[model samples]
Target: MVCMKDPTVQTICEIYEKLSKLDNLSPSKNVDTLFTQLVNTCIPPYPIDVTKLCTQIQIIRTKLIRLCGHAEGLLEKHYSTILGSFDTPLDHLYIFPYYSNYLKLARLEFDLLTQHCQNPTRFAFIGSGPLPLTSIVLASNHLTSATFHNYDIDGSANSMATKLVQSDTDLSNRMVFHTNDIMNVPGSVLKDYDVVFLAALVGMEIEEKMNVVEHLAENMAPGAILMLRSAHGARAFLYPVVEPRDLRGFEVLSVYHPTDEVINSVVIARKCPIPTVSSIDHQGFVTQMTCSKCAEIQVFNHQIEELAMEEHIC
Candidate 1:
């Protein structure tokens, strides 16, 4: 049967054209059958382009749908087993859309942050969940030097991330997976990151959140960007939370919530040098001073009259 020309058909045809070039053809038969079924199922009164519809169906069937199925299967088989051991059901603990939104916002933020950097940069993702958005972003483009370090508290999540990274050659060399707590991410291991991502960790206690932030602030080099997203308001209250206080060395450039249900905020902080303090001696009392101008605290000694005099003059 000849399919009539239509936008749907046109889209299908475009997708088919692209699929024809893929070297992997093992799934072609299944894809073809799925495509045909989708085209046939479309409500019909108007003329439809079967070929074009089939093409578009193939693209969706082969790429997005298939990947989604794979991801779901992986979660059920791997993630479910691990989650079942815990007291809470997997669904209760995880807010899927929250993570999904995080991925979307992270990509947009990363693009904005790295617009000026040269091709093939490195990034570190703290509290990296089952799906590492950073790996996806790096895989989206052909970056020769792009590398990702995904750190998470869950062994299962890290394993899943490793599998995802290794499955794609483009991501294999560029991604590294670590099963580590965000709060305990070693200082030596954290440095020179173009982008550092923190997502969904808002459910964690406020002290833990601040600890993670402090670690990032202290370890990250100058000009590094921190991308974060979390549930705010009542949702945030689910965990023993701490409001973000002023981070001594970092400046908050912007704060925003992308959606009403999700209190997702992004704080892009630039690192400033930590001022050093010289010891002061005054009347056998000692005090250390960070800086007189910044009001940074320091120790001072009463014995050093000269240093005290200098401190007073400043």
Candidate 2:
């Protein structure tokens, strides 16, 4: 339905061509002004490659952080400006049905995962922003309820999120919000959570993000799951792109797409046997599990490449 002749399509293609040519993907370095310009331009929402678009926006945001510094909460300021207030939040209104697609997609992914009825009933959501949208959606709709541990670095946004949670009696009873830097939290805090959601734009640098992933391995209770939120296809940069290649210290179980209009990818990973640094593979050791009774060990050669199964329909 979209024609190549459209100026927006032409501009998008041009941006892709430019990004493909650039050798340096460093955020510390200044990016071509055109890519940033292309992102901010009033482009139509029709049939766009959201993965590429979000990646480009992510580049622009990282550059902004590098140039402006996060000391004054520059990144949060920018994100909040774009998302606006959650009071009578547009996402909650869902005047446009697709507006809540992100939340629906998240819930669907959770369902796709195998849950033992006895699995821990606690979860932590990082970078929950002004309204813990996904957490809210899941907690309110699911047949099974779990405790939610939410965190945000921005003080004002954290307060707003807390207020939002309090406004709902069910959520106030079910959710807890913490105000702290996502990067600085002590690993001890990870002890109580069964699952942790890593937002794509957690306002941490690449190194900081990597540190969080590593710390989770050392701190999360045994059998805990880490649900990594990332932007994949279409406007991936929108969620600050993360691939299996960009991670360490956890065993990725699967890569899945939500059965909705939103095309972001959700990667589910779990803690593997802790190994010496020299023995670790791309992410972590190959999956290995042992039966408690017979002590029979099973080796799972499931790497990200071979992990995808028919667990969930996209």
Candidate 3:
């Protein structure tokens, strides 16, 4: 839907096209330069109403996501290959370009999870890519005892990820990878996890994203934590935006938008114990089955909404 005549749209399209066709996806001078320009264009230095072009940008979001996935896979594969040769590969995690970002993100998620569940026994990560750095970092630094179940649709990515962590004796026992679509994962299996982390790139389209959310809502244990990655501001062009309303069976606890290099915003929610009421009473009161979990979520959601507005991050 983008107008080819518009200079900004044209530039973005051109850059995306070139980037998609590139044979070498590894970190290189040319790849970095193109990605830099693309980022600058998508997120300008000065605010200029990027939302107006959101519809147009969304038309090509699937392609952009695919390109990003492929690029990330290549980068991870490269790193995995290099690290596979080392005896203490986990110790050399600093060599990764986005190692710092992963560390910060994992820490943030850990803090958020701890707020609701003090001592989580197990967690599931959907769409954990080839490197699975977030899971690695969280297991290594934060929750040392918690079992990690990583799910990825791509068998090759799962294979690569297994290779990366298989050498680490600590992680080898705790980290488990499943090569299957999250949709196919049974509810019985889902209810076992104390917390679930949905990766940013899991669902490329809004419908797909919502379907996954709905599925999790139906399956995940009541009061279990669900942490998902979304995007805000201009970053929505790169990743799907998960509004609070889209989470029907979950009570949103907090939404954190990072303005720095960490692209995906984090949304933490807890599954409702029972079905939530969809309508308001004549007195304009939200009618719901009252419970301890509902009471806590209502208080936290109100505070989070106010904070989001003041921070302009929701």
Candidate number achieving the greatest lDDT relative to the actual structure:
3
C-alpha positional error of residue 31 in candidate 2 after TM-score superposition, expressed in Å: 22
> Which TM-score value belongs to model 3?
0.81
Q: What are the TM-scores, per candidate, against the unseen true structure?
A: 0.51, 0.61, 0.81
Worst 10 residues of 3 by lDDT: 291-300
Q: Please give, for residues 1-314, the per-residue lDDT of candidate 3 as tens digits.
A: 33566676677788888997889877788987887787767654223233455566656665786676667777887887777678877878888877997987787677666767779989999999778999999999989998999999989888878888888888999999999999999999999998999998787777898999989988999989899998765566567778777887888887776655666678888888785445688999877543222222221233553473455422
lDDT of 1 by residue, 193-265 (tens): 7667775443244455676777777677765656565333222211122223444445444443333222333
Q: lDDT (CA) for every model shown?
A: 0.49, 0.56, 0.78
Q: Which stretches of candidate 1 lie over 4 Å from their true place?
A: 1-103, 115-120, 138-145, 182-184, 231-244, 260-263, 274-314
Model 2, global lDDT: 0.56
How many clashing pairs per prediction, in order?
28, 11, 0
User: What is the lDDT, from 0 to 100, of the residue 128 in candidate 3?
Assistant: 90
Q: lDDT per residue, candidate 2, 1-314, as tens digits?
A: 33345566456555545655566533322343644544443222344453333454445545533332332243334333444445533334343223466555656556644542235588889878764667877776662478988888767877766665565676778888888876667668787887888876663466766767767666776557778765433343233555565545566666654323444567777665553244445688765432111111122222421243334323
**Of models 1 and 3, which has the larger TM-score?**
3
